[model samples]
Target: MLISFGEHAKVVRLEILSKIGEGLQDRESGDRNTD
Candidate 1:
């Protein structure tokens, strides 16, 4: 059970990181367009 919990945590972390990365990319593109 503990091992599965750890695996679930890792997956959550990866999802959060990917979301942040996508947000950053969107902001960068928006900045370019404004310029």
Candidate 2:
């Protein structure tokens, strides 16, 4: 099995987006706790 460069890039982008989403969710929850 093999992956192309474009396909690899797509996977990398998705991983990055998911990480960013998690960070945002964590920040929002932290703010709620502070209040």
Candidate 3:
């Protein structure tokens, strides 16, 4: 259970990082694609 939870947390963290990266690129560089 502990290993599973650790893996789940890693996944969640990765998702959050991906979202933040998208936001940063869009907001800071006007690099967002609407398509």
Candidate 4:
């Protein structure tokens, strides 16, 4: 299985975005717990 450079870049970008999103969600939930 071979992916072009552009396709690999896109996959990497999506993985990073998802990780950031998960971190944000965790922070938001923690804030709610303190209130």
Where model 2 places Cα greater than 4 Å from the true spot, the runs are none
Candidate no. 3 TM-score:
0.69
lDDT of 2 by residue, 1-35 (tens): 79999999999999999999999999999999999
Q: Considering every candidate listed, which one attains the maximal lDDT?
A: 4
- Clashing pairs for model 3 are none
Worst 10 residues of 2 by lDDT: 1-10
C-alpha RMSD by candidate, in order: 2.5, 0.8, 5.1, 0.7
The predicted structure with the larger TM-score, 1 or 4, is 1
Prediction-by-prediction clash tally: 0, 0, 0, 0
**Which pairs clash inside model 4?**
none
Error of 4 at 5 (Å): 0.8
Per-residue lDDT of candidate 3, residues 1-35 (tens digit) = 35688899999999999999998877866544443
Residue pairs with colliding backbones in model 2 are none
| Residue-level lDDT tens digits of model 1 in 3-31 | 68889999999999999999999999999
Superior candidate under TM-score, 3 versus 4: 4
TM accuracy, model 4: 0.85
Cα lDDT of model 4 by residue, 4-27, tens digit = 999999999999999999999999
